[model samples]
Target chain A: MIHVDGLTKYYHDLCAVDQISFAIQKGEILGLLGPNGAGKTTILRILAGFLQPTAGTIRVKDYSIDAHFLEIKKLLGYLPESAPLYHDMLVYDYLDYVANIREIDKRQKLPRIRRLADLCGINSVMHQPIGELSKGYKQRVGLAHAMMNDPEILVLDEPTSGLDPNQIVEIREIIKKIGQEKTVILSTHILSEAEATCDRIVIINRGKIVADDRTANLKQTLSDKSRIDLTLQNADFASLQQKLGTINGVDRLTPIEETDHHLRVSISCQGGVDPRAAIYRQIKSTDWILLEFHQETQTLENIFRELTKES
Target chain B: MRQVLPIFRKEFRAYFVTPIAYIVISIFLLVTGWFFFTTFFLFNQANLRNFFGLLPIIFSFVIPAITMRLIAEELNVGTYETLLTLPVTFLDVVLGKFLACWGFIAAMLIPTAAYAFTVAMLGQIDWGPVAGGYIGALLLGAAFSAVGLLASALTRNQIIAFIIGVAICFSLTLIDKMLFFLPRYLLGIFAYLGADFHFENIAKGVIDSRDVLYFVSVSFIGLYGAHLALQAKK
Candidate 1:
């Protein structure tokens, strides 16, 4: 569990993390969605006890980050955005060193290291030096280091960044599996990744939390305005637009593309309106052939862009 | 205390994993060996007297080159954040790194014992003075490493760290000799504070507690400064 209240970090005059407050329950995967410089990394650093907050408080499992840092640190695993690693050391040696520093028992450290290496899929490269690994492998090794301690709280800053599509999916699956057991706060600009992995989403814009809710609920709130795309053959574009504008529940109608015999249109409709039926009847009466018509569902990307836009 | 050991082990092991530890020791031994051979055989000296005299001057540059990357490279490579995020306290990290550098310096001094053996074989050796010289060299190395660690903490550029470290060590070594222009009272205090004054006394095979205290105090001060800089980074 993590609680951040009125948390603010200032670098001279610029506020890195403005007065922001959020609480994450046990075993919850909270995605911190934000653009670059949205203070997401700063929030993660403060929670990990690496950066001291200039104002307010952070409580991890009832222990304040400032007052009980050692206890909180022992319970938390932080993977920074850069994945700071000692390049010259071999993968296994580096994790072994981390295990030792985290104070895991000598006898237990090797097995735990092996388990984490396998979990992050870096077992094959265990004997290779970290500097020689590719970016994807390096990222996995960083994740492996974080998981080595088996901390209850995991703070990952851009866990899927710089990975190829396949690696991203693999990391997403690993994060999903890990989230089932630990409290995870992952910050990422990739909206779809967050949508796929997180139970809840927290949208941060310009150092503030703008939206915090269940991912499904956030999508549902934006789903009221339905979108329909219509491609027509042999329809008069001007007259069709005017006639569709007259429909009661229709909010807006805009022609996307047009040719000699075909037209593509996007229609916005209010909640509970089945504009497809009306459009079908109108097109049939006009003697136009309906090539294709489909409703577009609201995606997390669309919602993310809409919410983070300048307001 | 428990956390310090792991950091120490990791840092000490890093020296061997990379070429840094070997390169530093090799260069130092080569240069010091050259000096010993040139002084004893070419100049016809019978003892390692010249070798001990030249060590502080050599360490003034070598120690910084060895220690410049201790913290600076970590910060540059972004590993500082990883270490800081661990449960270890600032003091533990600082002491562990300082000790690692100290350990490397000690290892470097190990091969120089051959020079001591060579001197004993060629002449009537006074073991007490030879022992005193090694003790003095260790203290000097420890002090230089501490100052270098502090300088390393001030920047992410290891080259800049090296330059600053060398500047600090050079100035400390030169300050006492340059104090003749100052008034009597100030010159007296400056001479006592300067490293050369204490190091010279120790090089004469004297185990004066005052000189020992000075090196220990400077080392403590340098390490403390390094700790503060690291804390500010957080």
Candidate 2:
């Protein structure tokens, strides 16, 4: 439902968002994962029509952002990072004001608000001053504000930042629920949150999209090198390296650590092959006692670290 | 116009939600009341000319205080993004906020009618000039509040907005006073542009379209400047 093309945003001499393009299908939950200063927020802001792009165009449902901004904005609901709120107003009053501004019908405002409050788990704190509420409740109120119009596209920037683990889980679950009916785009530095919440993950770094695919696919494609860790007793470093070096799938072997009684080594295997059985046969032929031999699969966290960490 | 109503409602009620509207209105009444009463006894006049006369100066400060937080606070709290990203036009937001602040000033002026009533009871009072003076005060407040809104839109700092609002309003009001230092050719222009130049006729119960147009033009320029500032941010 949203197509961004060559979007570039510059703040004076500094480029906040480089020329980047991506499309989000309707009812898809897309997570923008990036480290700090990765231009994730900048991209989200442009998509929400808050900031004009220095170059290129954003189109929602075939309407361009510059020409049909009001129409596009009507369909977009944005919750900025940190959930900036009016501290003086009560939660109910704030959401009501947002709903009014969103131009919801007067007859439906109360019902819509109640429904959103229940969905966001903020029904009990409706009458409390937003300033008096905890951070989690405040964020829930912000979510209700963003969803006031029942927008077709919801753009949230760091919706779970600064919340506790339980609050994070609650918000993730709420976003997951909302994602069932709406096109949701959220940005976060937390990889687990993105994996848990988003169907497709767009990993951004230095204002560029380095990886964009289905969450599972990204993990599968980026993690190509499998590792086998071995701990052995009464085995010399040279013998262990010489024996494991000639194995068919072992690409690289390096001793991790060694002591008088024990030695630890890791085998970098190629082509997703498990060389544990071959190594086990080799260790059985010798008198050296094998303490541990385990094969490790690549994790999503490893893929994230490999792609985003600075070379 | 319909979209502006929500912003107006929110902003207008926002004042009362905090102690700001009450405090500002109370201070305004107390200060203006003191000036009106003391000038009444000193000048021994049955007219409200002195009370109306001090408004240009009184409102130069008061209106800024009311309007300084309108846009600046929204920017500081990051609600500006949410508001602008909505379906409303920039004009709607500006007009709604301008009207709300102006409406508060109008509401605050409602109590000052008692000054006129007291003067009428104490002595012979002409209602025409009193009515005209109140109209002039409203227009003056509108003009100052517009300038204040423009300043508020220019910055995210409320104090800076207040200072800029006061500086612009004060300078415009006193522009005519610089006529002695200006060349003779610029005298008429300066006089015409002075914030209170058109207000004198209105205060004296002489309502000219020229004076009305002058206040409207100044207010239009201020509101338009505010609108442009909003666009520049994007």
Candidate 3:
């Protein structure tokens, strides 16, 4: 369990993280979604005991970050952005060193390292120097380093940044597997990563929390802001708008583009009701050909853009 | 304290694993060997006095080179963040790294024992001053390494850390030679401050507690300064 209150961090004149407060329950995978410079990494760093906040406090399992950070540190396994590990050391040596520092039992150290190597998929490159490995391999080594102690909480800052798409998926799968038991807090600018992996999402912008809710519930709550896109073969805009205007939930119909053979239009709708059925019934009585008609619920990507719009 | 050993072992092994340790040791042996043996026949002395004499100035540069990358490289590569987030404390890091650098200085000194051996083979050698000289060398190495670690912790740039470390260690070694230029009344304080002055006293086979305390205190001040510098970043 983690509790953060008024966690503020300032880099001299500029504020990195404002008075942000959030709590995470045990075994919850909380995704911190934010654009660049949105204080997502700052919040995670403060929680990991890497940086001291300018103001406010963080507590884990009743132990305060200010006074009991060493204990909290023992509870956390942190992977910094891009996984900056010792470049000169061999991967096996690096993990062995981490295991030793974490005070893993002398006898259990090798077996534990083997298990983590298996979990992170880094056994093949175990003998290679970390600098010689690619970004994906370096990140896996960083993961093994973080999980060496098997800490209860894992804080990853942009774990998938600079990786290939396949690497991203692999890292996400690893994170999802870890999320089954441990408390995992990860920050990412990628919207879909949050949607696919996190149980709950906290959307932050300009050092402020804009939205915080369950991933499913967030999209469900904004489902009322839906749109029905239509591609009509023969209907003209004036008559089609006139005919669809009578539907109760449909707010407005706007023409998108007109081709020689088809007329494309987007109908804006409000309320939680599905206006697709009524619109289809209205079209069923008419002679217009329905080439394409699909209602798209507001996705997390759209909601993210709405909350943290471009400046 | 318990966590210090792992960090120390890692840092120590890291030096040997990378080419830095070999390069530093080779250069140290070359410079000391060339300078010490070149004057060997001219002085015809059985003692390692010339070798120990060159150490205060030589170590001023050598120890910094040994220690410059200790903290600066970690900061530059961003591994300091990873290391700090572990369960270790600041003291754990500083002590571990300080001991590793000191241990490196000891290891680097091992090859120079051949110089002492060659001297004993050539002529009658007084083992007392030779023993004292080696002891003084270790103490001086520790003090300089501590100062270098402080400089390394002060900046994320290894070159700047090396330069700052060399500056402080060189000043400590050179201060005694400039004592005549100072006002008569402040002479004692400046003389006492010169690192070379205490190191020479110990190298004379006189293990005075004051001289021993001087190196120990200098090392303490340097390590403590490094600890404060790291804390100030937070």
Candidate 4:
């Protein structure tokens, strides 16, 4: 539904969003995962048509963003980071104002507002002043405001940053539900939020995309080497290393600790290899009783830190 | 044009949503009323010349306070991003806010009609100048509101917008008054630039094309500057 090609945005001398390109499929929930100053918000802002790119092209549907931004904007529901709202207006009034601005049909306005209020879980505070509401409620109101016109594409910049854990869960559930029908793109520094809510994750660092894939695929593909933890009885470090080094898939072995009668070792295995059986046979012949053997699978959090951390 | 209406409605309604519209209008009426009544008692005259004369000076301060928050508050609160991303041109946003601020100022001037009625009841008052004076007040308010909006667009802080707006309007209000201090050749140019000069001419019921054109030019330049400021984000 959205195609961004070699997009670059510079704020004076500093490039906020460097040359980056990505495509978002319809009805897919995509997460822009990055830390502060990683240009995740910049990319979202460019997609929302709030800022023009210094270079390159963005097309939503068939229309180019530079020439047909208004049309693209009509199809997008953008909730900026922190969701700046009119403090003087009530939640209901604020939504009404947004609906009017979005140019919703007069007859459909009330239903649309009510539906959004419900979906955003802000129905209870509809009459309260937005400024007086809690941070969570205010964010919900912002969500409703964005979805006022029932836009086809939803672009949210750090939607759950300030919310409490429960509010975050609630918002995640709401976004998950919304993603069933709309093409959703949200940016977050929270890895767990992205893992739980997004179908695909794009890791951006220093204004460039570092990795882009499905959450599980990214974790699997980035973790080419696997490590097996082993604890053995009556085993010496040198003998155990010599034995494991001869195995076909074992790349390297390091002794973790040594007790009087037992040794614990971490074995690094080459990618796409399982040497557990060979090590089991070797250990069976040595009379060194195998106490524990487990392979560690990489988590998304580890993959994220590895990709985005100082390199 | 259609997009301007929603923004205009929201902005115009926003004035009353806060205490700003009521407070500004009340203060304006009280100060202008005090000036008019005091001069009426002192001069024992039925004319509203003193009232009209005090307005351009009053607007130099009042209009800024009224318009300072129009674009400045949006920028401060980060609503400018939301407003700009909507399916409306920057011109629509500028025009909508300008009209709302101008409309508020116009509404504030509505009660002053009583002063005109009272002057006629007390003695013969020239309706021509009275009508021209109201027209002049509207034109001056519109022009000052545009200038204030330009200042508002230039800063996110309301106080800074007000200060910049007042500085510009204050200069225009009194620039002609400083002509005596200038060299002989510069007087005409300064007088032509002075808001008071055109305001005075229209207040006298002459309705000169030059004065009308002056207000239009000032208003256009101010609004155009504001439009450019809005588009600078692009």
Name the better of 2 and 4 by DockQ: 2
Q: What TM-scores do the predictions have?
A: 0.95, 0.95, 0.94, 0.92
lDDT of 3 by residue, B186-221 (tens): 999999999999999999999999989989999999
Off by over 4 Å in 1: A231-238, A255-264, A287-292, B41-45
Give the top-scoring candidate (lDDT). Answer: 3
Rank list by lDDT: 3, 4, 2, 1
lDDT of 4 at B70: 93
What's the lDDT for residue B172 in model 2? 84
Model 4 quality (TM-score): 0.92
Q: Which candidate, 3 or 4, has the higher lDDT? A: 3
Give one digit per residue, the lDDT tens place, for model 2 in A158-245.
9999999999999999999999999999999998899899999998988889889999787776456788899999988998888889
- On DockQ, the stronger of 3 and 4 is 3
* Residue B224 accuracy (lDDT) in model 1: 94
lDDT of 4 at B179: 90
Fill in the DockQ of model 1.
0.87
Question: DockQ of candidates 1 onward, in order?
Answer: 0.87, 0.70, 0.80, 0.64
For residues B19-60, write the lDDT of model 2, one tens digit per residue.
Answer: 999999999999999988976888887999888878887888
